[model samples]
Structure formats: structure tokens, C-alpha cells
Target: MGIFDFLKTKKVNDETFNSSQFQNEILAFALWKFNETNDYYKVEKELWGIQDFDLSEKQIKIIIEKLKVFNEKKN
Candidate 1:
């Protein structure tokens, strides 16, 4: 703990805040599209940038579950 440590800490917090804000923006857009079309699959696939991914079955199931929960909450 010394002079300028606060600045370093603040910088990390700012970066984390910015990242969270950006993620929220993307989620808002995805949810908006989902509400319009009721297409969580497309929203997850396209908006999540997983169209080209080859995820394992377990990973996909987890993703689907998360999306379902997200959609349910929105509704």
C-alpha cells in the first residue's frame, strides 16, 4: 500500500465495470431479438458467437439450460 495504488485499483475496477456494461448491452440486444421471435436457439447461437463452435454435448446442454433460465426470467 503506497501512493498511486488507488489509481491502479481504480483502473482495474473501471475495466471490470466496462466489461460488465458491454456484456449487458449484448444480452439486452439478444433478449430483444428473442422477445420478438421467441427464438432462443438462434439468439444463443448467433448472438453468443457459438455458430462455429463444436462444443461437447455436456457444454451444449449447459448453455441451453442457461439460455432457458435467462429466457424464463425475461418472461
Candidate 2:
């Protein structure tokens, strides 16, 4: 088997991945990516994408607020 073939294999079923227990993994990714970018406009624009995402509006707001804080803390 090719090295990349392992990535094609399902590490976890969809149901488990959607569970709250697996949720922090998703949040951590967004936070990490958000911090990686330097522009505030880019961050705000990217934040809007979560409006149509599967997560609730409250969750989206929380992430945006958290990201805003990330910039604030750096100054």
C-alpha cells in the first residue's frame, strides 16, 4: 500500500467524529488557523464563513470573540 493510502482509511466513523467529545479537535483547528493569519480584515472575512457552518451562531460568535482577543492580547 502507498503511504498516502493510510489517509484514505477512516480513522473514526462519522457519528463519532460529530460527537461533542470530538468537538475540541475542530475548534482547535480553527483557532490555530485564525492565529496563523496576520490581517484583521482577513480574519473578519473568514469569520463570516462560519455563519453557514454546521455549528450554532453562538459558537461562531464565541470563536470570533476569541480571535479578536488573540489580536488584542498581542498588542
List the candidates' TM-scores in order: 0.42, 0.38
Once superposed on the true structure, which residue ranges of model 2 sit more than 4 Å away at CA? 1-53
Per-residue alpha-carbon lDDT of candidate 2 for residues 1-75, written as tens digits (9 for 90 to 100): 887965553444457545776556554655666768865456555645543244444555555675667657878
Candidate 1, residues 1-75: lDDT per residue as tens digits? Answer: 988755542212334424766446545666676778787777666554534323444443444565677878867
Best by lDDT: 2
Candidate 1 residue runs with Cα over 4 Å from true position = 1-18, 48-67
Error of 2 at 71 (Å): 1.2
